[model samples]
Target: MASNTGNAFDFNLFKRLLKYTNPYKGTFYFVGVAAVLLSFFSVLRPYLLQVTIDDAIMPSDNEGLVFYVALMLGVLLLEVISQFLFIYYANWLGQEVVRDLRVNLFEHMLKFKMKYFDKSAVGRLVTRAVSDIETISSIFSQGLFMIISDLLKMLVVLGFMFYKSWQLTLLVLTVLPFIIYATRVFQKKMKVAFEDVRNQVADLNTFVQERITGMKIVQLFTREKAEYEKFKGINDKHRKAWVKTVWYNSIFFPIAEMSTSITIGLIVWFGGLRAIENDSLSLGVIIMFIELSQMLFRPLRQIADKFNTLQMGMVAANRVFGILDTRSFISDEGSREVGKLNGKIEFKDVHFSYVDDEEVLKGVSFKANPGETVAIVGATGAGKSTVINLLNRFYEIDSGQILVDDIDIKDVKLKSLRSQIAVVLQNVFLFADTIMSNITLDHPDITEEDVITAAKQIGIHEFINTLPNGYHYNVKERGVMLSSGQRQLISFLRAYVSNPSILVLDEATSSVDSYSEQLIQDATDKITEGRTSIVIAHRLATIKKADKIIVMDAGRIVEIGNHEQLLQQKDGYYKKLYEVQFMAEESLRS
Candidate 1:
């Protein structure tokens, strides 16, 4: 339905949408039954009008006219009641269907992996959750009902008119081709217009969210004017989409009105001539024809509106389904059991590339024994973090096998593997909630004592006590109320609460202030006691006490030794990195 663009409106979306109506079988049956009765009653009105005009009023028969008038009133009463019932059931079904659809969409979204989020914008998801569902609901509430009502009215009216006079019926229908021709032209253009507009609006929404979230950074850098101009450009694209949408709607609506109006004009022009020339057609029959004409054309116009709405909804469905169909890049069959691990890990012939164009980790291999601490140091993007990612199985390697306790990692269930290792990620994430709830993540069984014990281990117990509300204090969205170091401390506490066999810290103290850094380091040292910890760090001075330091460059391990042993390799990269940090430290002390 995309005009010269030649794209077809996805009819399958409508098919899927109707499945919701399957549950409302009683309502659907009622609509059909009421429609038949309503249409049956509609024909009676025209017949009663014909009798009243041609026989009762012409002969001035009062008793007969009164009885006919009573019949007409009763039919009117029945039609009104049926219409009310029809509208009620239609609305009830529409709302329930929309409710279930939104629930399914959100549930499916939760099943998607982290990569889906990396590729999709938040505003686009939000629009699908809200706007897209509403459009489909509108189709049910208005479109479905209108289609049923109008088509039924058309069938009843046409049958009656043709029975009364085929000549008049044919005359009325003669101009329908023009209406169809005009509607066909606009429907295709209008469908494309709405789809383009919806996509543009989604893009605009995405831009707004990105800029708003980064607004503080913009102000800090004094890039407000430049940001505004960038925003203005997106706004203009959205505006163009809107202009085409409104233009098609404006032109289509008036033209449809004129087309329907012309049919009525033709009926009046011809009907009046017939009545004057032959005195065969009655005034009541002409009036009935006029009423039926309006009912028929009205629903056709509504169909056009529904057509536009369906296009927008289908575009949204296409985007939503595209995500639903995307397979999680990292997943396990979860059928294999490796039992419990003894924390012995070895990476064999590992190779990986986030983008296929360039390798990040290539043919990397290392091993660590149980209860031993391994420190990883490298310049950024030197495959240091990549090693930890492999340990957690966040990404599947292209060609490699990682062994835990001499058992292959691929054979272990993801949950069984993950539960054993506690990760304190670099960018800590906290929900919008109270401190106690965030720490526990609403586990339902976690006690305040458990929270305190974890906080105590992380050296944050005193900090929480100093707050006015203690552990009950609000963390705000993403813990924005707290400093970066405080957030890191809480995340460390959360990881500690897990009490796992392996601890993976990704540059955990990089953002902490010197005083906070020392506290976090002390807490980290205590937590790593008698456990396996593979740590990634930027500041080389902190890892001096590490059992073994693995210096990595590009995608391979270049040196593996104790701090003093590595430093003696003056010709190596590790020694050069050490001297740079050592000089910075000496300058600070002086």
Candidate 2:
């Protein structure tokens, strides 16, 4: 989609990209001056040779020859210095620009709404941030600045050729239209080919990243062969995309090489005939034409190759900019900073949906007074999780007001609001770090001692100490080094250490062993005290002591009461759910 929006060498996109160079303008100007010097030096060498051959060698003046040779050597030295500065500084400028761009892009993504991530693939975004940005760097290092230098050098060479002999210059001009036309066609074709290549690369990255992440599922289900076959198909497509660009290059370069050969042949034939007929042309002039022809035509041929790099960089820039332009972030328009809320939460007739025309929460309303423990119980797809998501403002409600302390949450700074609450999700995630690091998440205010204190309060400190290194044990990625119950315990410690006024436990004890469940239940009771807690669980027994229970069915609250009050309604959804879960528990015990 990003490639589809722009031309191969879109001037508008190009100018927009140049704005990033404003920070590195000093280096950019240095590269520009280098280009001009390189070009001037390129033409000076051939002209020096012409003067040396015609004047010094013909008249047998050794001093004149030595002086011109020294000038030529000095010219070469300056050209090499200019070239070194051009390459080194151009790359330096490019790296600085992309470094700034990558940082800005990542910070922008950090503010995007949760729904944006839900709809995007992790691997494609990774490609945009990493490889695609690396390609844009080539636009400066190998493509744009280098092409400018080449073209300037070619122009200077052409001027020197005409100054020596217009007849030979005219002959060289005869081959220009055909090669230029061929270059135009090759460039257009390569643009499309390069776009396809980029698309295939992103697809390949996505497939590989997803498969690697879900390798456990593949192996558990014995789907290795099937997944491998699918990967081969994707890989074949990637190969075909790249082969298309290679095919275009193979056809274009040979034609350019043959054209260069023919133009040189024409210049020699015309100049030699002039030298024989009237002695109007010297051997030196003829040799200068030969050198100048290469200087002029080689750049034209190299431009086609460099243009491909430019085109590819442009395609990548389009993708990177596409993400930068996304407007999916939650509007943090509220300047109100409620320092340490009293934890009074109310949802007033909330209506919401993750997708259009399919509401997940329908006019759902509830209130948890300060320091009250509220429980929401329902089957899967009953919009129970949506309620918590809305509470955190992860997704915006369609038409509703969620208020904390009688202040509409929309009017509160997002950081201020989220900081006052802590959530322990059903699927706990821990970074690849020590247990202490994961628990504190490197929050400056939450120290290692504070984490240990919280863990002891929640009854997990003994379990943590039993690990290989106590609180310093590395959990590996996603806490794979720990059991499901162990990870859940760590998450609990994480929330407790935050010292939040409002606590949310979404199925925190659902998938643990009986012993771990008891530990978690004990931990839960300890943490929930004197805090406004929202417990979402399928297990009916977990929330019996909650001050209020809200039972939901099909996006609506079907019942709201304490355990005894809800059981009194025999035909209610809550009563039926309680009986089923109680019966299952009894059967397990028997």
Candidate 3:
């Protein structure tokens, strides 16, 4: 939850938001000029009515009446044109600013360390990137620019009223202080409500996103009813938060209307009495004062509303800037340029933990020479996957050195280092895109021909060709349209196309069918050839041909040897793990 300090308008936040308009300064300046012109033209309509009533109709001058009527139409036309420019340009500036902001925010998020994402919610980040940004746009369109135009309109109306007659102008403005006081109170209450609304919206998004993503688990465990109740509770909170804003609006708008009505009543009573007393007092002045009073009070009321938009935008800005200001990036100060070298990997005295004081990898050390395949086998929570994460530099090691090709991994450029390595996790994630696009990841350098060639080399090309669109087949969200094994095959093709010097298979074939398992094994042989490979698997038979086997238990390497040598030690951890973990799979395979 983000804190809201209850300030309805933060001038610092406003200034920071204004900086994003630097790219569209011409549009911003044009909108400002339009606002000023709009103010001038809007004030003329009432003034023209005053002139025509006083100087043309009363004196029965037909020529003067015709001229004043023409002038009034011209002023109305100019006001309309000014309004069109103000609206069109202001919104255009807002859209352009937010588009750039969203891009910058997403790019910033991409640089964050894996640890940051581990502690954050995908739904909340999505809310910040999409929904929160949209609200910021409204700050410029409905809040800031509109408020300025309205304020200008108010000032112009007040000036004309005073010039016409100060006594009546003063009387009409008596209700202003009350209205202003009411507005201050309304703004305070609404600020709290709007903040609550934003918080609840984020909560709702997080809840729905998580629940929908994990809906399979909910149904598998027969917990749908329970989850529905939880969702309803969150949905109810969202409803209540918005209802608070509605309550504030319901109470405040009528008060503004009553203030405007009271001002008009006071002007009518006093102005009528004054006109009766002084024969020179014209009806035009009274009518004009009524119109002018509405103009002044209407904007005051709208400012209260617009202030909510501005306040919401500031709240959103604070959240967004909070992400942008985070210094939790994995420092990439290494300047070493990656070039062709023997694919050697070494983890010397590596110690790491995902959380404070809870080590998951404890002084573990290993070496895989060029063209060697090292199989890491361990039970769940034995830190098998942690080793892969460290090798890829997804999380920084607390204290240790990870060297690749005789160079410390931390001393190499992150992009260059990762570019030479490829990982295929147990849970393969495919984007909602065509199969060809997913395989290439939209990389222009890796063309359709490259993908087809890679897929053919891996023996999945025939299966892909049987599909309706072949390479162009759309793998819907998370590749849900394809079976689990089929998705894994697509991942293999993706990795093969990258042609990395080092390949990692993190239990890649753990859950696939026998046919898919055979396909993966063949593809694995082809891809891992002439490269350093690390295979993290539970199936003992699949890794029997590896150059070395490293068995881990409780973050420590308990055994290190080839399949035959490790099996020779009857009481060793590797022998025990092989018996327990692979016995069932071996039986099923036979």
Candidate 4:
């Protein structure tokens, strides 16, 4: 996203966010109430200064001084107590808000259609979900709290100062507009700077994630030096952004300090002249002005800093709210009226694209019987993947009707719709948990037997047996602890565990060895015997055994037949693909 979505802060999004954290109203309200109490205690410092000058120092009465000193001490204790409450609540609220925001953002992201992920950059998503939300939490917790309490303290102090002497108070008040103007200007610049900072951070994060994931490739190709240089470039960009942010901070603080200092100097000069004349000005009034002037500085500094924080946080808020603002392309009416599917699928004249500039699947039409293996074969970017993606309602077709058992797939609730189907994509994602837990995805109250059953069926039980912990072995993030083939098999087992009515294997066996592939192929056939199965593959051997094959080129289906029929059409695209694969296999055999 943009700096500010639609140029308005979007209160509706803010309200919706509050709904999730509203369960913690006790903590939120306590922070607010504690802040007001802190403001009340802040007003007493000037009161103490006035009493010391009027009752003790001015008249030289040591007897009355002790009582005032004790009173000041008591107020100090109250201030301490209030400050404690403020700190505790603000910290608690900050961490809690961050937790809640992360949860909400992730939950919303998961609910989105696959097309949303396809369009989003992982780096940008991480920035908004993590650092951006952190900025917002800081603002909501401590920043928002301090702004209100300090503003109230400033107002109360101003009232007290004016009552002591309106003349000096007005002189002090003259600097108010300058502070406000400076804050406004500085805040605008800081917001823009921090936005760049966030982007640079995202660039750097992407570099790090890619480097770590591709460490093997970098090592094998001896490209570490080149990769390091590329990484340093982004890292340097991030450094410059952070440096600029510091400079903006440096300028705002001093300017604010100097303005308040000038106001204080003027007040002192006026107060001193009045006292020399021995006019109505008492020492108490002069001392009070001095103390109040200092008090004004604290809030002035706070307000200036707060404005800068608000600016930086606005970028974060906008990004977070932007995620919340996104309306998924495919929406269910929440009317979970559809029951189990009948396995019949129809794609009628579908036209689709990831972006409007180019279409991926164009005017594709097909039908699948209840229990048939329909294999799709195409060159990369020729719309083989797009066909299954449409079936899953990942992207809404520009124009088409995808009927599942006579009901438009879009009409079914997303959760209900997805739960009825299982997909094993080319890349598998395994969690950092026990193999059993990963198989069940930590489904609560699920027994180990449920996992063992799926494992045995997918032929991964033998592999799990070799591990020391067996079912208890932890699969590190993305299953890094397992070999590629093992991870693939475990993923297959996980899918089989779900027992979905419609099974989609998108190059499922492409990563497996021949022996494992055979075992999986046997399992696939046995399991999908009376269910709908769709396979997308480039390997001609795999699909040769499929009941039907659809040959596609450039988003359109050019031919369709059983294995033998496509071979008879010798001049077609399928024949060329078949010949290439056959030759490759023959060479391997030789």
Error of model 4, residue 32, in angstroms: 4.2
Residue 319 accuracy (lDDT) in model 4 = 75
lDDT of 4 by residue, 150-175 (tens): 88888888888877789898888788
Clashes of 1: 0
Pick out the ten consecutive residues of candidate 4 with the lowest summed lDDT. Answer: 1-10
Overall lDDT per candidate, in order of appearance: 0.77, 0.90, 0.88, 0.78
Q: Encode model 3's per-residue lDDT on 415-517: one tens digit a residue.
A: 9899888998889999999999888898879989888999999899999999889999998999998888899889888888998989988756656888887
Instruction: Indicate the residue-level lDDT of 389 in model 3.
Output: 90
* Shift in Å, residue 112, candidate 2: 0.9
TM-score pick, better of 1 and 2: 2
Worst 10 residues of 3 by lDDT: 1-10
Q: What is the lDDT of residue 232 in candidate 4?
A: 86
Superposed on all Cα atoms, the candidates' RMSDs to the truth, in angstroms, are: 3.0, 1.7, 1.6, 3.2
TM-score of 2: 0.97
- Which consecutive 10 residues in model 2 have the weakest lDDT in total? 1-10
The TM-scores of all predictions, comma-separated, are 0.90, 0.97, 0.97, 0.89
lDDT of 1 by residue, 1-590 (tens): 11233354556666766777888888878877876777677677767787787778878989889988998898899989988887777778778887888898888786565546767899888887887777767666666665666677777778777887898788878876777677677777876776777788788888888888778899999999998998899899889998997888888789888877888888788889888999788777777778767766776787677666656656655655555555765667757665446789898888887666578888888888898888998887789877877788877788888988887878888778887888877888888888888777776667889889878876789988877699888988889988888887777777777777888887555567987777677678777788888888654445787788898999888999878899898698888887787567657757
Q: Candidate 1: minimum summed lDDT over ten consecutive residues — where?
A: 1-10
Tens digit per residue, CA lDDT, model 2, 157-271: 8887778788899899899888889988888888888888889999999999999989999999999999999999999999999999899989989998898999888978888
